[model samples]
Target: MTQNEPAATTGDQETVALTRPPTALSGDLSPRSSGTVFESAEPPAAASGGEPPEDPPSAPKAAKPPRKRRGLLIGALAVVVVVALGATAVFTIEPVGRVFGIGPSAVPTEPAPDPIDPDFALIPVDHVSAGPTEAGLASALQPSVTAAEVGTLHAVIVDPGTGQSLWGNEADVPATPASTTKILTSAAALLTFPADHTFTTTVVAGPTPGSVILVGGGDPSLTAVPEGTDTLYASNPARISDLAAQVRENAGDIAITEVLVDASRYTGQAIADGWDASDAPSSYGGFIEPLMLDGGRSDPLNDLSQRVGDPALEAGNALAAELGATSVSAVDEAGSPADGEVLGEISSLPLVDLIEAMMLLSDNVAAEMLAREVAIERGAEPSFAGGAASIIEVLGENGFDISQLELSDASGLSNQNLITPNLLGDVLSLAAHPADESDTAVSQQLRPMLTGLAVAGASGKLTDRYPAGASAGRGWVRAKTGSLTAVNGLAGVVTDRDGKLMAFALLSSGTNATVARPALDEVTSALRECGCR
Candidate 1:
């Protein structure tokens, strides 16, 4: 890589002769040079098979060999740049000053496109299977559960490749599902509704003039992103400001004075029966109301922030503020106007987006609303109990067994909720395998759950769970996480070392979540490393 030895031609490079030799400028190196002294010369010596002439015919005083310094100064010789790759050397040169006293012009070229940054780094798209033995897989995973200080733990690992059980330890028993219940909730929602279905919110004329109702259709993705800004959710939901503008437009010659909210699409207790008192209004859980902003998050943008006590009333109040109401208007329940005079309408993000958000963030509020949506679709009451029942009904109809389950709430926030590792595995396996099985329609729809599950050490709830000890599974394991003070679960699909997809469920109880979560994570991590054939 060193300079070409100043034309000595060292290393692997050969010095290419300059197409034209350097010549002294008839004039000085400044302003004008077209009218200086001139000299006529013969072809350069290199082309004539001889050395440079003793002196140009018109040199200032050259009849004999010129002085060494004078020759070097007069003809510095064009610099020829050489580049070598392996045994091949390429030479290039930029001719400056003059070649035969003529200046060379550079060719014009198109500029390169500006490089744009990619959203995320590319990861391995293809998985290679090591094809390990199944009996060996069971032997390898059995101890992660049996050797731990964890109590009341159950685990099941099944290869999605052959629909065969690879490992299990008390896996058929029902245990607290924690937030993992959202997985079932998500599957049922996708099963009962179209992937593009959106929760609808409508604004209609109220019972009296100068009044309007913001009818909540359970669109939890709604946000107040000003009149023309984007929301993090793909929905681009109905904004209260937009509704207010429409209300103003319809009211024409008069200023509307009041705004009301109707949140009756879902009817039931705001809180599930078996939920702990502290669960709601906490950072992780919220009132299970039909209408809420940003999943009832007090901060609207922070998923882990505390929730409001009455999400519906808060939403109504937000609408009232947006409408510039002088006084707080009492919210009332009412259907859309009988005359079909609608002021505004907004649809939540497509149902698939809600499922992804629920699974990625383990969003309890979104999960509950989706469950109720499932209930509504199934001709059942849109309540917690009804939603849970509807999920069971939908899953049972889709070739999954729910006989050993008790789902008190759709969110799995209730300690009373129970689910078997076997069901979890079966549900997950449904997503990994083909759609030609029974309930083909349902299975096809449920396949999106695979994408919704957070990638290990990469996204959503599972982002921070896979530490260095589990580095082997990073970007390889995909799973949903469940955690309460004493309950922890991890269940999802993973491509085993053998490249065969595996569905696993690890539910543990009677241990601190801090300890149980990592232990369960280790179990899934084991699946990623297992090459069971």
Candidate 2:
């Protein structure tokens, strides 16, 4: 499932105090048009008939809704679009959310984002009994392995409750993981980067007087979202207008003659190797640049919107518009500032939020950006080769076997990438229950990964799944989905009938998603229903 095609085209609570470069591509990416485009749940400027809201409310509000992010909100919307008996019914999720006053949208003014805290209260495994006997579990799952199971399926189920490998079938064999590779990218990111990490976009005095440079700090959340208006993608963005205001203050009357975009932080080709040329500017696939607005979306609000070919330039234009500069002249590698004085800077959301967005939307560009951020953190070159090498290095440092895996790109957009189901399940196990329970440090750090996996028939990639036979897993199974022409996979955690937490990874090849998706869903469904005591 090269995410470049279906991925954007696609969290948890752990309260670890997090703060750093802050950021949004948004909570969840809505999949629409051509199968590759996506949009976060940002507020549209206008309403019905492009009209404004009936009236502005001048009242304060009360009530705290569930902690909402783009993934959660979009996942909830997916539930409504699907599974609802009344398909033609017209309704709005906002009013329903407002009645309860759960999210930021409910507030008249957006409240400052709360610090990173995953409040990890996953059904405690202390007293939970082991899952069904291996034999019984095998019997339960055997029905799901139709003739389709021949030799293409590689799967693993881990019962974290008992800390045992519950099942495996060719699980250790590495194969093309498709988008399931994001699990590795995200895990490595969380393990190494701070809980609250952020990418920064800065405005520094350029090499010459009267020249202003907008340096790309690998911040994609920087957006064209109008002032005071918020979108999921721009929950907390580095605004060009803010930069403009700061520059105006610093340079008394000296007019800014030019706005230069500094994209020197990243090196290598804009598009990654093994990627389709069309994927670079596709709604789902965007060039890997340090600076992009709304994830390289031209419309800034629609995921299906055309992607700008030169995001660095588009970003420069956005800043130029803010500076009141009629047009941007050119883009060049920015030289060191003459003085150390910084004109202005804006930070992205912490690393936690970015990781959540990546998992929720399966954002290929976001995944690449995060991996590059990791590369920067590790002092590796910030490119696909560097990111791929760094992720492998980080995973090896953390004790995962590096010998079994081969990675081409961070977002799992490459058909050449190979990973085993065993590693996938192992990663999920680490996210659910770490090496040290007494310290619980790993659990605290990796908990967000669990929170971000798609819920069965409920959210994210699983939204349209589980409509009927797999209903047992609805809201019960939480995992990631991977699909390519002849590949399909699912990986994530789920609480079973015994209330036991389990991690599972199923990677299948030689079959289309239509045939393999339901078969894999049935496997998770079997887990949810199996109460073998």
Candidate 3:
């Protein structure tokens, strides 16, 4: 039969295709030798009764054809194709094993990651450490003064590098900071406003020929002193005299018959809501108005004056009178002058310098004026309320926490204002230096302002306070002095033995300022000498 034909075997009653067999199959046909006999003829009838079966002799089993090598070769080719297909699927598919029936363990999986602790992730541990200990620098400041006096004293020294409480009683308590409050105000102002900002005072032509209206820009430093009256502007007063003369000169003998003063740039609101009504108006406690120039006029006769009676309008009028002007009025009702001509104009010292003066001398009128001016610039009402809101807004933008702070006015003239030492300390530290390495304007401005402060046993209100060698500190303490009826405070930078600068604030409340001043000075002196260890 052909290779494609099926064959029937007697021993096994199954059809089999015998085209090719394994190479091991033998070619010899010795069927009789084993147990069965294979013949070329049909088998004999069983008992003579069966007729002889006739069938063509099955074709001699073709030599179990030489074992086909092609079968093995086809199987090997099929295996190679399957392996290649599996590899292609694995390379092309994202998650390969799921698409085909292959070794599952061969697939790779990303291992689970460790979870993070939220609390530990948020804390900033760069500069701070654990709580203060008795054996540390804080313990060195332990009070030697008795408890009876301790309750009346708010004294403490601190290492600015570490927030360690060095020494004192009632250090944690809040107290009226007095002029010390200016530190906070100055820092906030400097941080919030640009250093080169200049305040404008315009001179517009009035209705009358040769007459000009001096528009107030809340410039407290406007001066008219001829050449040399004094080195400082505070001592030597200069008004708008030269400016008006120049205006007259430009106008060619155009007599300034009527000079109208415009003081409407700022809102009329002066004193803050929380200020006490009974405080002396001359004591720097009077509410600050935007229009009243020169710390609300130091003269007593000027009813328009808010603090000392000397009104900036009066000063302007005096300058005009000296320059041969007919009249001067401090009325805010003047309309915009006619466009006759533009006259001379003067600008106030840069905002940075003004702020430094305010901070160093603790000038209440200047501080209040600046606060209101800031409000006006921001397009808000130039009232104390508006100023407080603006200050808080600026502080918040700089990442400060204003929850515990209360600001009724820019100057600490009002007993209603309250701030914590910690908060003040934090602000001072950040603003102590300028942000740009090349610009030392802030530092230079701060130097002049600081010189205005009352030095111990030298100048200002502290002319004769601390004696030499109070506790190991002498001639080394330079700080701002604060005093109120029930509050006294001293806060500033002190250099230790190793030349390390340390910033500290000591505030005392519910005590006599006169009695507490010495204690505060003593603590400051002690810190200066590194007596607190």
Which has the greatest lDDT?
2
Model 2 agreement with the true structure over 259-307: per-residue lDDT tens digits: 8777778777776666666566655667888888877877765544556
Put down candidate 1 lDDT per residue, 251-337, tens digits, no spaces.
677566776667778888767877665566665677777777887877654443567888877777777787776544445445546
lDDT at 86 for candidate 1? Answer: 13
TM-score of 1: 0.73
As for lDDT, the candidate ahead, 1 or 2, is 2
**Residue 295's C-alpha lDDT in candidate 1?**
79
Task: Itemize residue pairs with steric clashes in candidate 3.
Answer: 223-238, 224-238, 224-239, 225-238, 297-310, 297-311, 298-310, 299-309, 299-310
Regions of candidate 3 where Cα sits further than 4 Å from its true position: 1-136, 144-174, 231-239, 278-280, 283-287, 291-294, 297-312, 331-341, 433-455, 459-461, 469-474, 531-533
Backbone clash count for every predicted candidate, in the order shown:
5, 29, 9
lDDT value for model 2: 0.61
What is the TM-score of each predicted model, taking all chains together? 0.73, 0.76, 0.64
